[model samples]
Target chain A: MTRFALTLEFDGAPYMGLQRQPHGPSIQQHVEEAVHAITGEQVTLHAAGRTDAGVHALAMRAHVDIEKAIDPFRLMEALNAKLRPEPIAVLGCAIVPDDWHARFSCLGRSYIYRITNRRAPLTLERGKAWQVSAPLDAAAMHHAAQHLVGHHDFTTFRSVHCQAASAVKTLDRLDVVRDGDGIDIHAAARSFLHHQVRSMVGCLVLVGRGKWSGEDLKAALEAKDREALGFNAPPDGLYFAGAVYP
Target chain B: MTRFALTLEFDGAPYMGLQRQPHGPSIQQHVEEAVHAITGEQVTLHAAGRTDAGVHALAMRAHVDIEKAIDPFRLMEALNAKLRPEPIAVLGCAIVPDDWHARFSCLGRSYIYRITNRRAPLTLERGKAWQVSAPLDAAAMHHAAQHLVGHHDFTTFRSVHCQAASAVKTLDRLDVVRDGDGIDIHAAARSFLHHQVRSMVGCLVLVGRGKWSGEDLKAALEAKDREALGFNAPPDGLYFAGAVYP
Candidate 1:
């Protein structure tokens, strides 16, 4: 059997998310079905990260093993051709060692949250960005986010549905930038607790709106209580940007 | 009657185009219907330009006369609220003099065409960008486009349906720039014939693909015949970017 690594880009509006869902359609289900059509094998697809509903992926990495002898380029072309009418695109394919697990071998992950900071209703960016009509001070958001860029107990910033054992994790980066009427928050970490990035972004926006301060963010971090969470940003603005490996 | 000028942004995938069509929905039709619902008046909406089907607009300028005494901010907010779920936004609204027309008062117009150069099919950019899978040399396309940046009889570039009295129009700018897997073609002029920008972009793509050269483009321009045109890029990649006023 030969293992193949696949890079995918998908719009999450139509699917449940990146991982498989028994209750609804997901990116993985469609991709695996396309693979089954091409190779006639019911192989499992492993992904680097699992995105929630309405969260997009720019370059999500996945892996699958096949017994059929197929060129990577031809496999990619066939998968793309078969995944038509769906929003998923197989960007790349490459042969990998059997032990190169897409999930376990990943060292780090990054996500970017997009916010459209404008009073006007979103047109071109609808469903792709979070439209915040209230004026936000991005500088304040950046300053407050600095408190989150280190090792800390982030119980307050995690989702109730998170399956991670420990809330204590190290955050590598959390940077907020403003461009025109848009605000982008880039977050990187070894691994994030479910909803950690969205929870952090929500509080940062509160600080940007002057509803909270940097001291408040730090206090919430120290509290380690879920009830102390300020807010949870919607999944619509989140995107799985990339995965890093050793 | 107070004339209110509106700066609009829209995703043109839903409507026929920006103008009111006899058989189809349009940006003007929806905006006018919203105004009638609010003020009970049959007011006409004048736009800076007419876009073909599926051509988006970033900030197309337009004007409508409203007899109801309403603040610009309120008007903008109400219009946005009324045009809900239509992928149209009123970015700005201001009172303009009666003599200032959205179409005639414009000194220049600018457009941007987006091309995604990649092997993968588009997902997030479906109906929004033209996808070219073949290798494209943007520098070669830029060099060929420079030949179009002056006063000339552009019958070869103009559409058969173009109603301009004269085919001679000075093109102020035609620039091609590549960013990652995307190519953007920027065009500016006082006025352009129907399909002029798309025709120019199609020939530029041919030049980028080595199917044509700068000399061929110059010869096409000199031919000044509609049959001399190479191709016309689809409306999906074209955007009515902005309008210049003096």
Candidate 2:
């Protein structure tokens, strides 16, 4: 059996989440069904991250083991052809070692949250970005984001439904920058608890709106309690950007 | 009567065109109906340009005469509320002079064509961008684009059904720039014959792919015949970016 690594890009507006659910469809279910149609094998697909519903992904890594004697290029083309009508694409596919795991072997992950700061309602950017009518101070938000960029208990930012064993995780970076009419918040870490990025971004937006201060963010981290969370941004603007490995 | 200028942004994937057509819906029809619903008066909406079917607009300038006394903000808010679920928005609204015309008074117009050069199919940008699987040399396209700048009888570029009295028009600018994985072509002119920008971009893509040379583009312009055109790009990638006025 040969293991293949696949790079994926998708608009997550229609799915319940990346993983399959009994209630609704998912990226994994569609991919697996496509694979079954092509190879006639019921196989399991593993992904680096299981993104929430309405959360987009620029490049999400995954892997699957196949016994068929098929080339990577043909496999990618066939999968893309079958996945048609669905907002998912296999950007790349390649052979990988059997030991390489899509999730367990990942070194780090990164995400970007998009906020369109404009009074006008979003037409072209509908469902793709979060719109805030009030003026936002991106510089101030950047200052507040720095407080969360280190090893700490992020319980205040994590969701109550998070299945992670511990809240302590090292955040590699957190950056905020304004581009034209929108603000982009980039976050990187080895791993994240559920809703961590959105929660942090929510509070940062408050700082940008002059509703919270940098000190408030630092204090929230110290509290390490879910009740200390200020705000939780929606999943519409969040994108699972990338995952890295050696 | 008061002439009100409305700045519109829309995703043109669903509409037949910006102007009303006999067979399908249009941006004009939607706006006119919405206006009538709010003011209880039959009105006509005039635009800076009549974009083709499937052509998007970022900030399309239009004008409508209304007898009802209403503030720009309130009118804008009401229109937005009535146009709900549709991918259209009123970015701005203000009162204009009685003599001002959306088309005749416009001194210049600008458009942008987007090409996503990649092998993978688009996900988030499915209908919004033209997917070109081959590699494109944006610099080569830009160099070929310069040959179309300046005054010329662009009969080769104009649509066969064009109703303009004269085929002669001055093109102020044509620029090609690559942004990440996609390429953008920006065109500006005092006026344009039907399908001018799309025709030019289609030939530029050929030049970018090494199928045509700069000399070929010049020859096509000199031929001054509709049959001399090499290609005509689809309206999916085209956008009515802006309109300039005195």
Candidate 3:
């Protein structure tokens, strides 16, 4: 048996999410079906992170084991060929050790939320970014984002349905930057509870729009209660940028 | 009557072009319809450039005369509200002098063509860019493009169906830049013949791929015949980025 690590890029508009679901299609199902058609063996695929519906991925890492002998290039090309008409691409494939698990072995994960801070309704970037008509103070957003950085109980930022046992997690970085007319919020951590990034971004936007101050954001974090959550941003602007493994 | 100079943005996938057409929908038609629905008076929209099908625009300049007494902000807001579900936006609207025109009075126009230089098929940027599997030498393309700059009778680059009265036009700038996995071709000029930018880009790609040398590009330009044209790029990557006026 050979284990392969695949780097993926997908537009999450049409799929329910990254994980398999009975109600609708997912990235995993399409990839699994493509693998089955190629290897003639039903093999399960494991991913580092499970993104929500309408969330995009730039370099998602996944792993699969197959008994059928195939080269990495051939597997990648064949899988990409079969996954056509769907907004998914196999960016790279590499053979890996059998013990390397995609999810369990991941050391860090990162996400970026894009906001088009402009008055005009987005045309080319309609679904790709969150549109905020009010002019944003990115420097203020950046300053406020610092309040959420470092170790803390992020209960106020997590989803109510999150299954994680503990809300305590170490946030390595939270940065807000302005690129042209767009504001990008980048978040990094060893692991995150469900909807953490989106929830944090929602609050930061309020701060950028002068609704909340930096101290207010820190107070919300210290509250550690879900009721204190200002808002949960939509999944359209969230992107699983990449993962790191030791 | 108030003459409004509107800064427009649109995704050109669903339209025949920027101008009104008898068969299919156009950007002008949508703007006109939106105005008619709001004011109950038919009006004409004049654009700085008549872009082709599938050619997007970032900040297209246009002018419209409305007989209805209305404010610029309200007119813009109402037009945007009425142009719903379509990938179009009125970025800005301002009252302009009656002598000002969208097309005839324009001092300069700028365009950008995007190419994804990679083997992987585009997922997030499927319709937003042209995908070229082969590697491109941007420096070589830039060197070759320099030969086509300045004043010249660009008959070779003009389309057979081009309606411009004269072939002599000055190309102010043609820059080729590489941004990570993408290549951007920026073109600026006072005016251009139909399909001029695409034709030049097609030949520059040949040079980048080592199919043609810098001398060959110059020779093609000097030939001044449409038969000498190497190719015409697709409209997918073309964008009417903006316009300049004095």
Candidates sorted on DockQ, descending: 1, 3, 2
1 versus 2: better lDDT goes to: 1
Candidate 3 lDDT over residue span A22-80, tens digit each: 89999999999999999998989999999998999999999999999999999999999
Give the best candidate by DockQ.
1
Error of 3 at A106 (Å): 1.1
Regions more than 4 Å wrong, model 1: none
Model 3: runs farther than 4 Å from truth?
A: none
Residue B202, model 2: lDDT of 91
**What TM-score should be assigned to candidate 2?**
0.97
What TM-score would every model get versus the actual structure? 0.99, 0.97, 0.98
Most accurate candidate by TM-score: 1
Per-residue CA lDDT of candidate 1, range A1-246, in tens?
A: 999999999999998888898889999999999999999999999999999989999999999999999999999999999999899999989999999988999999999999999999998888899999999999999999999899999999999999999999999999999999999999999899999999999999999899999999999999999999999998889999999878
lDDT ranking, high to low: 1, 3, 2
Instruction: State the lDDT at B57 in candidate 2.
Output: 99
Candidate 2: tens digits of C-alpha lDDT, residues B112-198: 999999888889998888888889999999998999999999999999878889999999999999998899999999988899999
Model 3, span B1-246: residue lDDT tens: 999999999999899999998989999999999999999989999999999988999999999999989999999999888998789999999999999999999999999999999888889998898888889999999989999999999999999999999999999999999999899999999999999999999999999999999999999999999999999988999999989989
DockQ of each: 0.90, 0.79, 0.80
lDDT per residue, candidate 2, A43-134, as tens digits? 89899998999999999999999999899999999999999989999999999999999999999999999999987778888889998888
